[model samples]
Target: MSDVLKLEAPLGDVIRKSKLKAIKSIVSSFQPINNDKIEFKNNEHSDKNISLDKIQIVANRFITIKRLGSGGFGEVYLAKDKNQNDLLIAIKFENINTSRPQLSIEKYVFEIMYECSYIPKMFYFGIHNEYTVLAMDLLGPSVEDLLNFCGRKFSLKTICMIMEQILRGIEALHNHSLVHRDLKPDNFLFGLGMKSHIVHLIDFGLCKNYRHPLTYEHILYRTGKTLTGTARYCSLYTHHGLEQSRRDDIECLSYIIIYLAKGFLPWMSIKNSNRKKRNEKLMEIK
Candidate 1:
């Protein structure tokens, strides 16, 4: 066991104030896992923990069948488009505090990298009355949720198979020099039924695009920030907001594989953080 990262600080408050204006400045910047020591700042005010009904989703001619789920940036819904097309689309509604340029970047990234089997194909993205929303092909239950329902951990064979498919998807992003900075069990869908099921890569909202879509010389503007991924599985360079490489993806992939084999996170803390000292104790071993 090791020092695990957890925060007493009300991070939600800080996020809202940002209005998610910057590209890589969101919660993804906060290393949420093995970073271990967290020094809380009580300087932020919180976003109103509004009731679910407070925000609304209105798509043209599409009726919401049910809400698929919500994430740090937005909630995805299952819906039917016009002409009664049996469409499974995810609508992501980002709060003012979450982001908007994410919508533009996601479109440019996924739209260009079409044809990878596992990455959920994006249909369209645009502002629906000042709110940034995305429509992606709705995917099935995520692997993390499935593992919980499976009761026991996955078979080694199953884990390998899932990893293979995920790598297939990651390879596409790697080719484009983009990083799915937020890779986790929760981001993959293992599909439904007895036959071969589809495994999909979902949620590119936290994706890191290296192209630097706009022109700005600021370091954060030049590269990117580690704004939206979990720390346990995040690579070291990503912690510094550097655009990730194929090597970095491999590192994160290693962490997830280890997590599946063991029942807990590999770097999880057994004691309260002593992060300031002996932090690199495990570095030499790795």
Candidate 2:
């Protein structure tokens, strides 16, 4: 969400009464303060969906403005805050999904990387009504839109810069043991003019704090789900949900770089499994 949402996130004690017992249960299970990985695509659970019959907002001071985007979860709102001391924020408001855990996990991960220059800073997070709201810094245009305008053409220097920033963002996440399994140009944002652009890591909705063991089935190994990223940039293990690390981010970014430089993917020559075919085309890139 950016300066582009409809249902905005309100500040202060906007959280109201809901399934108190269930909320407390989840908080307790996560142990209030035992750091765990954030869930972008959380497993569906029986108690995932809950009714919000309780909760209230304290600093209820927001002015609704426009719609950013809409999807299965809910609509994002771009709004202004009279009490925000003159600041812009992107608000994400989703209906109660006590079963789903992505927002909660996103709050934690965004908070952790809030200080990283490579990532946007989050402003606030809370659960209100039958909706969970996450307020964050207003980032700009999506890289996909930018690419459409640039049209398969970019200087090698620009590609290198983008790759560097992507690396920095990935390194920041890895340093904290977080894995942004879903990475593509659309997840990145840049300034309007594109001259002075900043690549933001957004949509923590699918992020994973992968739990990898150093050793496995007779050898040192790792294990995890094989939730593939965008069809264009994902790797083999990423597609299989096997394992993810800093290197995967690099590989994915490489796809963007090649796309920008050549106006077409190297893999255009082959049409096999994205992981297999894309990997085969890697050598021809650059």
lDDT of 2 by residue, 29-91 (tens): 110112234322322222433332223231485444555554323545655666777454566
Candidate 2 has a TM-score of 0.66
Q: Best candidate, lDDT-wise?
A: 2
Where model 1 places Cα greater than 4 Å from the true spot, the runs are 1-59, 95-100, 192-196, 210-228, 239-243, 270-286
RMSD of each: 11.9, 11.9
lDDT (CA) for every model shown? 0.51, 0.52
